[model samples]
Target: MKRSLDGFPKIEVNTQRKEGKALKKEFFRKERDLLGEEAIPENAYWGVHSKRARDNFPFSKKVPPSLVKAYFAVKWACARANLEVGLLEAKIGNAILKACEEGMEGKFNEEVIVPIFQGGAGTSLNMNINEIIANRALEILGYSKGNYQKINPFDHVNLSQSTNDTFMTAVKVATLWQLDELEKEIINLQETLQQKEKEFASVLKVGRTELQDAVPITLGMEFGAFAEAIARDRWRLWKSRERIKEVNLGGTAVGTGLNAHPEYIARAIVHLNEITGLPLAKAMNLFENTQNLDVFSEVSGLLRSLAVNLRKIANDLRLLSMGPRAGISEISLPALQEGSSIMPGKVNPVMCEYIEGIAIDVMGKDQAIAFSCSSGQLELNHLGPFIAAHILEMIEELKLGINAFTEKCLRGIRANQERCNELLEKSFALATCIVPYLGHERTSELVQECLREGKNFRDFLIEQKIFSEEELKNILNPLEISRPGIPGFGKVEVKRP
Candidate 1:
């Protein structure tokens, strides 16, 4: 095992080139000239990344999977887009597509070592993908790795594109893809709640006291509210998708389209859309697209909205399933893991707690993305790297949060019918249902008498002989009286028994 001068494990260099290969000699000369005595190894294209960035910002672990996916997605989209526009040859486009297929099939693992965080606003990530794809294509063609003569990273893999356009475009494409999955899950959760609502629509309980009766409501109404909130969020996400569709492809190198054929830009967009089946369009104004990252900010805001609703729903679940003995206990959540080491049968809302924490992280990432977008200056966005990192992080975190909330929290939640009935029977909140029939004055007097004399409102009315038992039962039918789906109402239909 070779070791660095500082005593750490040194990276080994492997090359397919034979001794005295012309390209290999040229690479060594360039390496020595670029890096001097402490030269970057001839085999390592990502030397700048490892030697500089790895030790400086050691906070994040290996590059996140989502960010990796985004990098590949951008490369794939750019290749196809360039091919369609005729800027890149069909063979190059085909090679990029092949590389993408291999990547999707898990070809590149940890072996292709490149740090996710680097300087130059994602230039390292761009080069990493280019090098990987070029090398992979070379293998397919029976050529040596890093042999640009056969498959050049700049001339072939990154043909007619720049980090500015490719990186930003890839971010948009990847985010849109994640949002598509998110929308589906959100819809599924909403439908689940709606189904629960329809199932629990009939059962009712007494209001004000066990002795006094009050208006009624079905259990489904409560769950339906949750469904509606999720649906609204889904709509917001759908609207945000449009913002991502307008990609910054073809805006090569500072959005000038300089040194790029007009046909190349148009063809790339067409090819990208054809390959991905995503509604991607060539940016109308390349300069603005490259310089402005407002679209990412818009997408982040929508994601924040989603995270906010997720937190709200999780909090509600925790409260609704608080206690089987002391809290609301109106619902029961499916217990997954043991909650305590010593306490027997203790099951905490662990899934909800996890989801809440994930949402908080997403919220924090949203702020970071917002700041990155604002940091962009003239001619080119300087914060593309951070924006991509933050948004990708947000996507993965939200995906996990949604899945856990659905499977662990929503799927496992059960209405505590017995507890709901017990609470409804003891609540005075149903008094508003009676004011229409008895007049406000009489209703107030009856409520005060019941409270002051420690008597049930229904019993007090019956004892005073103000209404017969049959009429009282008809008026205070808890099931029928609470039937008003809309909140803040006075009259409840008296169900004749």
Candidate 2:
């Protein structure tokens, strides 16, 4: 008998390629289950059940590592609860605890080769973890792989748990973890927007309604609006966290707690909160938690809102930075790459485009999450993993997308101050500002005259002496006109010539 350098008895799964050919021979240990026997790699920590799952799930890709670690966390909590209730033997439970601790650190994540998409409602995933922890615990106790006789996967590591409850619990826990990260990203972007607002606070530009100029505005105020939108999203996400913290653990196999001990079920939330360091709570009604997935759908709805806001913000930036020579080039984004292969001196708002694309992708995934949540059957939602996949994917996409958008675009954006002043000067939209001073009838007459003569409203106002230079400056101040309350309304009558 031989042992590997890692100190486990030699049960190695290896392949050697010789002269462009696959391995000619290999070795494995035989493991048996209710489905009969199967050969597994002798040194591989995962046993027959994991092997069967990986074989069955040919199309399964990588499960999110967050979900994987969260699963480990759930199991660790369960083991703790089981030990407290006298359901798990101290010697064997301590070994399982060590194994679970390693798994939480991502030590055994790669060994979980089961595919994510399958018909078992994440049973394969649960069993895969169980097998890994069991075998690793066996090695810790001076045993070889496939030594389930020393520490059985289902009997010992998985005491007082069921796939129905544990997997869904892990999903909620994992989503919460990712949500925390996403909230930080949103706050980061929101802070950047606030910085831009302060930076461009005094910048004057033409404000538009329905894509047509309506009035004057400060560029800082527009960024402030973006910040406000993100703030709302952040609030919604924070509120949504409370809903998902109520997990369905201890509701074994349909909320009946059939095989789970009463003490374990009673103490489940306490252990989970201790392990995850979050304010996790047990479900108020385990049965309702077991079958109903409306909570997840609601969270997905918020994600949909976030995506919409991001897309809207990106589009606004794209339009503001649309043209350098002939377009509404009121702002300039940092150039990160070649804009065109054929046109020289050409640049595009690719960062804005990228953010918009991610938003749309998030929206599509949000729909998938909704569909998956609503598809649950009587006593279980077989689509927990499915919903988890889409939600986790959206969180990751938004995080990276928001980071890229802020770093590559928002932070580097420069206000085209000269261009903004030029557009504001050229546009007659400022004509709306003088209504109170000139009265409606007189203001319209002057506006038509300026249009007929092809003159700017500011120029015409100055040329016609509609107000004294002091009064005109006061009436047409971009900050004064853009703010709330009537501009030049409460003041004494303007000095008109």
- Indicate which candidate wins on TM-score: 2
lDDT, candidate 1, 1-497, per-residue tens: 45433333333445557667533332321211144423344344333433444545555445555455656666676667666666666766687678866764556745335555556877766766777787677666655454556677778888877888887787777777777777778888888888877776654543222434445555566677778888998898898877689877877888888767777777767766765568988778888888899888888888888888878878877876888699877788888998999999899999889988988888898898888899887787777877877887787778777876787778767778898777764565445656666667777777787788886555666688766667655654545555554332333343222
Worst 10 residues of 2 by lDDT: 3-12
Query: Model 1: how far is 189 from its true place, Å?
Result: 0.9
TM-score, every prediction: 0.82, 0.94
Q: Give the least accurate 10-residue stretch of model 1, judged by summed lDDT.
A: 24-33
Give me the displacement of residue 384 in model 2, in angstroms: 1.1
> How far is each candidate from the true structure, as Cα RMSD in Å?
7.1, 2.9
Candidate 1, residue 132: CA error in Å? Answer: 1.1
lDDT of 1: 0.69
lDDT of each: 0.69, 0.86
